[model samples]
Target: MSAWLRRGTAATYAATLGVLLLGAPAAAAAPSAPAPTGAAAARKAAAPPASVDARLFLYNEHGQAAVAPGDTVTFVMSTAGYPENVPQHKTVVLELPEGVTFRSATNQHASGPCVPDAAGRKVTCTTQDPVDQLPATNGAWWVTTDFSDELPLGEYVTAKATLTTEIPDPEQDNNVSSWDVFVATTGDMSVAISAPPGPWKVGDKFDATFKVHNFGPYRAPFSLSSGINPVSGLRYSGWPEGCGFDPGEMQCTFGVLEAGKTFEFTMRFEVTEYDADGISLTPTIYPGNQDTNAANDKASYRAKIIKPSASPSPSPTGGQAGGEPTLPITGAPAVPLAAAGLSLLAAGAGALLLARRRRTS
Candidate 1:
């Protein structure tokens, strides 16, 4: 344990520890070194521009028959834009045709430019006043207007409305887009039949009427046919005197009807004596070669014939009055045995009394 030897050992250990710590830091720094070039930053900045497409669509609340000369039709506008950052709401101008008179306009939850004509006949709109502006949330824009009383009938009229979308383009000015709306004239034709209850008794006759209406723009050709419901015991009277089917039989007839006009056909039917139960009286429309769609093709009227409970003849023994006889009576003579025997006894007594008188004399 010499002091000089101990001091030399301590100096050597301290020097070793310092060398180990310095070497450890150099090794760590070599593996964790930062790159001089920023490749990720350059890739993000040089990315390609995104593609954008915008579309607008208009729909009428009423389908095929939505438009009428004096009816109000609603037009709904919607838009779809790509590149999620695009702005949806903007100024919209609706140019209507002479026939379509704008009554009033409104926008729910929108702010900007809106102006209406002095007579409230035409509506000029902007972001501040959208004739029919949709919310900022992309979707439907709707407005309804009534047809002016001056709108003429019997003709198809078309009107147009325009919707403008302001798409924000910070890099460019005047970034407005527009869509078109179409309004069409409306009309329809329909027919219905009204008939009385059937199952009429034999020799009974009845009348029925078929009413046809023009609910649409133009005149339509219609046909009517009347037939007996075999199950109803009812039959159509053969060709009413002045009235006859187009083909000469009462089976079918044709006629022309003008818009808003009503036409009726009266038919008569007779109930036959031999007609069976469950027979029906029916009338049907035969729209032959008509341009009307199948949806309006034909309508039917029906009545049934039920057997009557009373009859002239009494029921045969053990058989129902209305049903065929179970047993039939045959030709046979009737005899009375009690009268024959009484006559025979009288004759015998008279003969015996005569014999007794002769013997007594």
Candidate 2:
């Protein structure tokens, strides 16, 4: 009777422990959260749309952000940001502004040339082969556009470029790029150097005058640089406040010169004893803007160095009035000539004295 009671009590305790262990987990477990809705749901869904990427950009061949009217400018459509994920073919659609016309598009990596539509307003660059690698995959195209002859100066022109690939882009913001260029005007810029008068000897200091003139229908705001090439024996001093000097070059800047306007400054330079025959100053002007006449953009001024003449020997003044004629003594010392003349006189007197003694005897 005792064994049966002990076994029954033990079995009841084990059953209660098992029930507590199973019930505790369910009571401590956290509740389930609600699903995302509306914009949040949309954003989550769009987060991992695609693995590939496409980006577009437009820039000139020179990498400058401006363009000139009546000029055929070469532009680059760069899709270098496209990824090398799946072997996907890429395409670029270039939309030009109204006054700009597409001339041609070429890609060194493409199997064929980029083609333009009938109106020449749009150009498409696509490679038939899949672009899965860099360089070998033609990642860029060179496009040419001819601006209308009448594009107004200082106006802003915008060109847009769109890049697409076989794979979808997760981010649409980088798929298109636009470039804004200012319609630059033409300015004829020329430089003139007025060096101080010749007879410029060593150790002489003088002013070298420089004049930069813009003979234009428009002002020159960009690409304007003027400078003087330094001569070996020339020393620069009293430099113009606007000019800068490196070791062997002088750089000058004149900001925003208008048509028929000129900027003048003088620099003082001294000649050193170093053997420099003549000084030639070639001041070059590169307006960087469209120059109508380039012939006069560079001017050269050459100044000759005159050497001091050797003075002629002073010939004895032609027989000064009532004065003895004096000959220019040449060779050795006057003492030797005087001694020879005395010896000759002594011999003649001795010969006369001996003859007189013989007559007396």
Candidate 3:
């Protein structure tokens, strides 16, 4: 083709692209989000040039390249996102749902810090140390995450991964990857809670902290129940769901607890009376899809309430007011026998005369 004809075709193609990507989507979703502008239009038109691309792929453990519930996933990522002469950096961030767990980096492609958020739902793995940037030919780096056994089968949980760069990726769609995880069953679960150790006071609120431990090879749903001891008078003041209080009992049901993992919670209870110093209730796991051990599954949680004491009164010789006083006995000479006898006789006659006077009066 002639040089003039080729140049005219190129001009037409660029105009069409500018209208397609930079103009159309922005016109629809952008107006509802941000006000329309010519500068914004120009900026959007400039970012993706049809060159940059990053590929993030997910694979199951069995090498089938598919994800199944209760199985670990191998993530392979590489970069064609930058030019050969220039080094491309990727700080990958992934937010996993509740059922999926982040494993370790067996052969980490790039070296950086892997940190999880407080909820453990999101993790950021970056290459910050001696080795950084994606090597040539999409030098694939691999990381892993797993779905727990307790995860509900036939449910989909979204997994989002992002790659960060100084310049916008031309193929930004590949910079982020989205996939759904399908959960499957593994085995039975065993859950146990340590009884609260306490000699709590009566009529006062106290936390009945329980240490719930999962003792199983596979992750499983954690649900527990116990009838309120009628004699213990243990009542809930502040309760959370997964926990229920009926007229005679209270029960707790947790979504899932990972294998060899422990969870803790403080259930508020007020001591009504000291009738049962050692409060005990039979705790049992709410029967689920898989429950193996019934013996250890049903355990007792025992706590002691402080016994009441009665106030004591002061002793007679305790020096308290209104108490009987001690008698003093000083020495005195004994009276003569005749004088003693005459005195006794006079005293009797005087007593009789006084009695007669009282009767006459």
How well is each residue in 1-361 modelled by candidate 2, as lDDT tens digits? 9999999999999988887888967565757688878744554455433667667777877654356777887878766543442455678888988889998665465423578889898988775642334443556788889999788785667888988876777877888988766677766778778875766777888887778887777766433233333356777776665567665566665446777888777778777744445766667776746778889878776666555567799864667567878677589898998999999999999999999999999
Which tens-of-lDDT digit does each residue in 1-361 have in candidate 1?
5999999999999988887879977676676655434643343345333432445454555632324456676654554555543444544444455666565446574234345465544555544322222344434445566766566543344544345555433332222333222223334556666667664667778887667677646654445554445533445653433345432124544444576788776767677654443444345554322334455545665554566677689754786678866766455533456677789999999999999999999
Pairs of residues at least 3 apart in sequence or in different chains that clash in candidate 3: 69-183, 112-126
Best by lDDT: 2
CA lDDT, every model vs. true structure? 0.52, 0.70, 0.60
User: How accurate locally is residue 340 in candidate 2, as Cα lDDT from 0 to 100?
Assistant: 96
Residue-level lDDT of model 3, residues 1-361, one tens digit each, is 6999999999999888887868766587654656546744553445444444555554343431224456777555444444432333457787787777777665644445566777666777765532322332233456677777776653446777777764456666777776654453434444444545776777866565556566656565656776555444666655566687776577786666677777666667677877654576666764333446556566666677777788798754443467766565345544666688899999999999999999999
* Residue-level lDDT for 220 in candidate 1: 43
Clashes of each: 23, 0, 2
Off by over 4 Å in 3: 1-188, 195-201, 230-232, 276-278, 287-289, 310-361
Query: Measured by TM-score, how close is model 1 to the native structure?
Result: 0.33
